[model samples]
Target: MLAGIVSAVLAALVFGGVAAPAQADPLPQLATIGSTLYSFGDASLCAGAIDLALEAAPHHPGHVLAHVTPRGYLGGPCGNQVKLGWVGSAGLQTRDVYVYADAAPGETITTDLWVGTGPAKVMAIAWPIRSTFAEWYLLVP
Candidate 1:
């Protein structure tokens, strides 16, 4: 009888809808402050300084100059004069900015400096080619 009871309990436990323990989500590496986003990969290097600057930007709705780096880039200075565009509910504004290699550390290859109020949508445009570009969204603060 004891063995039968043990078997019955085991069966109930096994067939029941009890779920396993839940898992924790992975932590993000990017550092965000208010409406601004900053990435400082390998905090031990110059990126730390840049990240600090991004964090200190004024918290307001404005047009920002973003620095973007190309993918799979190995080394060297990543600065180039690129045409950038900002799109918001108002309209689209195109301008030029210097895109550097070591801009945003880890999150994405893009970083920004608040220039003025116009639009939140920002991107890097390749001139002449006109076919390739990279984009990022800025939240209004």
Candidate 2:
């Protein structure tokens, strides 16, 4: 009789009585908006964008330049000259910045602008020849 009771208890524990703990979905590693790619560092602000960024760079290198922007604003010309500077090295480095606005949950929008190697220069081609570029993340909040 005792053996039968012990077996029933064991079966209940192994089969279905206790509920498994719920876990949140893993954070994403990459995000892409148009031709641009966004790579995130360990201290990334948003989780969803991280996944998108990773998708953009599956086998990314150690040093990369990421530009994040909204969906419709990519075609616009630079308002002023922006210049960024950075030292190139062989170590792995990531720079993540929020562009435009904070990404709300379930809000799907093109938030990544572009990714590149080395510094970026944004030049405005006009009468006087205005040029701009900068190091680090561009158009970030």
Q: Candidate 1: lDDT of 6?
A: 98
**How much is the lDDT of residue 103 in candidate 2?**
39
* Local accuracy of candidate 2 as per-residue lDDT tens digits, 1-141: 999999999998888777666432222221122232232212222222211221222234232323334222222211211112223333232333333323332222232223343333221111112211222322211
The residue ranges of model 2 lying beyond 4 angstroms of the native Cα positions read 17-21, 25-141
Candidate 1 deviant stretches above 4 angstroms: 1-56, 68-80, 98-119
lDDT of each: 0.40, 0.29
Summarize candidate 1's per-residue lDDT along 11-104 as a digit string, tens digits. 8898785876543222111222322222222222222212111221333344343434332112422333456665755477676544345433
RMSD of every prediction: 14.3, 14.3
TM-score of every candidate relative to the true structure? 0.34, 0.20
